[model samples]
Target: MGTWNEGAFDNDDASDFIDDLAEAPDWRTVIQMLDHVTKSAGYLEAPEGQMAVAAAAIVAAAVGDVAILPDDRRDLKAALGAPPQGAVALARSALARVVAPASELDELWQEGDDHDAWLTQIAALQTTLSASQ
Candidate 1:
């Protein structure tokens, strides 16, 4: 990374950007990726443990439904079925626990965005996580 010039304002930095976000990559990409994986016969048969969990986390985060375990999805829905809360309530609760807990994510929408900010945020979160744990 290059040192910022002293006059650099917010416009001069790409650190908080995710390049692809500038193009507004949509749910279609996330859905198609999931469709491809799930349509594969062996997709679910991937070995369990850390690797599987990690892959699932990636996919689930992309789809904005990370808190629901793959196998527990049905059970989760059933438990919430016909509850007092409405769909909006359910969605808000899920968002509160989204794997990507980012705000002003649109700030990540910069051309030539190196995504360094995301890496930095993840590192910080990991530190906070370890400290809490």
Candidate 2:
């Protein structure tokens, strides 16, 4: 099983660190990590609340980079636009939903079964997303 950054989803300090990374213009590492988390979330099975929670966790880590800004920040928008299609887009969308400041990741996590379906979905999404790139 892949190890998750449990602290990132459960604590403020870890979230702050992730937030700082997301804010950096050169966020390659952050992006890659988010990508990984996206794949992980996709694997979550339906009715499995943790899927959303995992997605939310990943999104929270990179929301600063993906969030839409006012017209003044066109450059930021262009740089962080959604992925074209397939798993990449799906992953991006899932992450976007989770990190949306108003989202409740803990709630989602608390609502689902711990099945391997999520892992499968994430693996497929990861393969498709990576191949597309």
Candidate 3:
């Protein structure tokens, strides 16, 4: 929950997740992260939400939507080339869950002054992901 700004990767959990992706960059890693949110049964924690957002962003970037991506994370695109089959759909699903009810990430942002901005960021990521579908 150590979020600094509203951008998808502008948080501690997301930064850590990216570092982990750098080690074993692969498509499944992104899917697995997204599944943590899309397949969740109960409340989604902020860290998981953050990681999922980062994962979705990677998928978006892989499919040629790099507008929302940070410069440092862009290199990951080469390490993990084209997104896996159905990745765009999975990313879209995960993003919907991230901003939905019981999502700690969403709830936390709603409590902050920049909630609208945070939401706009997520929406942009979703829009980018959807475009590739």
Best by TM-score: 3
Residue pairs with backbone atoms closer than 3 Å in model 2 (clashes): 42-122, 43-118, 43-119, 43-121, 43-122, 44-118, 45-118, 49-112
Clashing pairs in 1: none
Candidate 3, run of 10 with poorest lDDT: 64-73
lDDT of 2 by residue, 33-90 (tens): 4455444534333222234333333332223333322233335334534432343454
lDDT score for residue 114 of model 3: 99
| TM-scores for every predicted model | 0.21, 0.28, 0.95
Q: How close is candidate 2 to the true structure, as a TM-score?
A: 0.28
Better of 1 and 2 by lDDT: 2
lDDT of 1 by residue, 41-77 (tens): 3312211111222222223332333332234232333
Question: What are the C-alpha RMSDs, in order, of all predicted structures?
Answer: 15.9, 11.5, 1.1
Candidate 2 wrongly placed segments (more than 4 Å): 1-15, 22-24, 41-133
lDDT of 1 at 1: 26
